[model samples]
Target: MQRSAAISLTCLISTAVLIKSSPPEVGFTLANSVQIMALSPGDPNSYSRPDLAVVTHTNLKLSVDFDAKILRGWATLYVKKCGITDELILDHKGLNISSILNDADDTALQYVLGEAVEYGEKLSIKLPQSESSNNTYKIRIHYETSPNASALQWLQPEQTAGGDYPFLFSQCQAIHARSMVPCQDTPSVKSTYSAEIKAPANLTVLMSALREEVIESDGATNTYKFNQPVPIPIYLLAIAVGKLESRQVGPRTHVWAEAEFIEQSAYEFAETETMLKTAEDICGPYVWGIYDLLILPPSFPFGGMENPCLTFVTPTVLAGDRSLAGVVAHEISHSWTGNLVTNANFEHFWLNEGFTMFVERKIDGRMFGDKFRDFSAIAGLNSLKEAIATIGENNQLTNLVPSLIGVNPDDAFSVVPYEKGHTFLYYIEHLLGGPQVFEPFLKSYLDKFKYKSIVTSTWKEYLYEYFHDKVEVLNTIDWETWLYKPGMPPAIPAYDNALIETCKHLTKQWLQWDENTSCPFNKSDITNLTSNQRIEFLDELLLADEILSQKKLETLNEKYDFDTIKNCEIRFRWLRLCLKGRWRAKVTPALTFVTELGRMKYVRPIFRDVYAWEEVRQQAIDTFLANKDKMMYVSAYTVAKDLHLDING
Candidate 1:
């Protein structure tokens, strides 16, 4: 006779309260003899017990309800029972769960929604004893996302470029996926997923998967099907709904955006296919069949998110000259470094970002000589310096592997991982010969860890194993200081200074010039510099001991037309310089720039600079308050902390 398992609803609810009150070190046992740990060993931001039971595949049937600003859906999860556990624990933040049912028999199952915590809440479900010996079972959860889900950003028609239809997109990096769907919301768990999303007939829906087909529409809504065969962490799950159009840029790539941006986006990313091919030549193979780009609205926060098969980018990168296309290369590199071999948790984020940064520059070097690659590395070092100063020299967050036990991963985000991580790998490459020797190890590393999530220790073990002959050389380096110590790396790489010297010379000339001296610079001074070089010039000026005088700034702007530049990178640095120089006339323009687009790279610094100016501090706070609702959740949250505002408020 088959044994049945049933849990009392009241008892489960009381258990949830007890779990909430317990400390992080506590563990609770369920009625079905499974233990729910406070946090996963590899992922402190989640409450899922993947060691016991993990989701292997997910099938989502969600409908976009723009009126309600929510996603009503049912997620059917195929779970693999890893241990002798009869209960499954998932992560959820704010979801209205209606019912839980066994897929095979359609029998109601008992579950409990735990009290909320810093990351989210624990969702414990009792599993029925299996009659067969199979270790996998199907479980279905019926729920609706909260209107104010942190993973989702709902925009009105006015917020979009077309001003004709509303828009919706998701940013689930770190630990926000729990707000979208209940699952093993941690990078420690990788699962393939298929989705059937329904949206208004007038709008198009897209996901981080290959588009299969569109079912017949009923004039009001259309159902779109997508399948992602490559297993991915829940954080990479993405969706965008809007009035979008697409242009085929290459045999394997398409650029999607609103009608206003379609032509330019297609032109801007026309070399995407080339980048993909170059990446393949370096990183083995591009397992993701199709590579596409989605240009989100101005309010999109990051430079780009490397969702497998589809990349979500910001409009700020459309500089028209393709100078900013390096962001595209970075995302493509993630197709192998991040999307293929995953970081087990946010704590080891450098494994994802640092590896991608290293590969991105390699791709750049392959296209534009080694000097250009070294030039980019120098720029990245400057960014790392700025990040360290902002985060504090002694702060643990500056470490490559930060302790995020009680901290939100979002708060710990910075360039430390990207640059510092790259520095470590670059140092290793120098020690073990150059790219000639390191390139093979790169391929080997990806091949061994493909389709799996791993921690830093695992990666270190593999690295040492790969370079066994050089164990003596590796031991000579200090691992503890590099990985755990705060502040910048101990040593900087010998970057080629050929490209940066020109920018530095121009910066010095401007810095030494006096207000009384005849404006020594002319238009020809910067005419020969590339867009990236111009940005480097501006960055050097910002790091000076004193801000340039207002007169000098005006003269500089006059010669270079910095005030009217379209490239976001140059414009961001120029705006910060103006504010630092106390150029009152540019304050309004600076506010306009911060409000216009929500990319945190530009927004956070501009806002902080303005706030630093005591005269405009209140004004900056007011601007952020009025426009915070329009910013992405991560952007708003980080900017709030930057301004010292109460996050809850």
Candidate 2:
């Protein structure tokens, strides 16, 4: 044939190829089945309609533009056809969609975005194939997130510890993933992913996936690649770029942070290897390859976020004595509970947090002692009681399984799930004749749901199935109350009363001295108590039937020098007592403390507690306003809503 004839035939064949795709040769086959056990209400936090096409693998090729504070990327989703739906819908909020294309570059897939909703907008990609010839296809979306994308936090040069280069990080939990990329942004959908991120050569890029070798650059741009061998929910997706450094803590663990904090962060999380061993011994082998941590700046709101490989943590956990390593233990426990096995949706969030808290305590027990674990649990119980009282038991948010329909999952966030969920698990262990019988079952449960998501009902079904012999005993417990009833567990857990009562006795002695004006105790009495004991003591003191007098407040502070304590946990409780007693002299220290720390765990409540006093309410508001710009979105909003102040100004 002539050259012209050959070219014409080739063009005809290319056109045919663009119209449809051949089936995927190998992949997780669930993409072909319709609705393979996603949760009810199907992830209230996301706008994506996953029933149509379930994304299995995501390839993100992006440029991190620090100058513009944007991530411009081609999010190519490899989806498996599940039903007869006309279009594939993905979740996207505050993103600028530029174009969409099929595998063959010649064909641009027609797309339309719905009016932006709170969670995000729905991106609908029209399918070209009309028959079963194509079972899978790749949809490449070229888009850039807005400067104010809620998921990405952009910090100025001065805001970072380095004081040279700007910093950027992404937090996609509780539905914020939609703001970063268009995909099935629900926990109900899990998918493996690979990322190729380009940034300035001066900075480094890290993600939730394994840190593969970094490739060379064109001029000043550096390209980094990562591979997530295990499938993860969208919320576990993460990315960070900054003047970052890393040092190995354990064999498989590395602490990634700014240069100034690398050594201390490594020291703080040194025991991660032991925690990982304990967790695996309890719940199957650790599947996700390397468990490292990213110690974020002061503005990171949460103590730690369990984001698969690189768990994002706040620098505050660097308390020199390693007292705060519990946060690391908690995040590592998520490797088995929250990350490995996940909640089906935000409503059943306890499935993630509760189980993580439980495992965290167990690991703590193994590392320290059983008494150390009880000290933590007793503290957790006090928190649970306070949380229930604050939220009001009747409010559904206090329930283990909350009804999050039409509600922001963040609004419903509380300690109820973490504490109450752990209690429920503890109750189960006790009823099943303690740890020997229960620990093995825990491993089996995690193994059964590995790489999967489940609702509260699903967890219960597995519970009964796993303990076939003890099904009758499991049934004896008040299942409805634990699963559905709001506020507190069906019955309070019996914590190791020794230390808790000791703390209470110490407080009682101090309170009696205040009342009688002849207090027998002095600061020397508490000097010997451990930090955990001090925490419990302060907590119990604050729960006194009557407020302390100004003179008594002075006496307590002078004796213990609570104002000078180094631990933030103890310092926070001491400050709260001052606010409660309206101790005027101590107010300045509270304001100073609140301004410097942006962790919501401390900032929000301290703001609210101090704001309750009319004399210094404005001061609290002023302090918050002065530092609001420095706070994370999570911290800023929680304080604003709790105090009824609009922080945007």
lDDT of each: 0.87, 0.80
Q: After superposition, how far is residue 70 of candidate 1 from its true place, in Å?
A: 0.6
- Candidate 1 lDDT over 219-251, as tens digits, reads 899999999988888999999999999999999
Give TM per candidate: 0.94, 0.91
- For candidate 2, write residues 1-649 as lDDT tens digits: 2222222322232222223212222342563222221212355555565555677788999999988989998898877666567787788888998888886554688988876555667678986564434467778889999988888888998888989999998888887888889888877677788999999988999999998878778869889999887878888999989999999988889999999999888888888898889888777888888998999877787888988889999887787778888898899889988777888677788999999999999988888888888878988988998888878988778888876655678788789999999999988898889989889888888987777766777778888888898878988999878877788788876777776777888888777774555656576788778788898898987777778778888878777887677788899889888888888877888878877767777877788788888888888888877887777666777788887887554
Prediction 2 TM-score vs. true: 0.91
| Model 2 stretches with alpha carbons more than 4 Å out | 1-40, 130-134, 515-519, 646-649
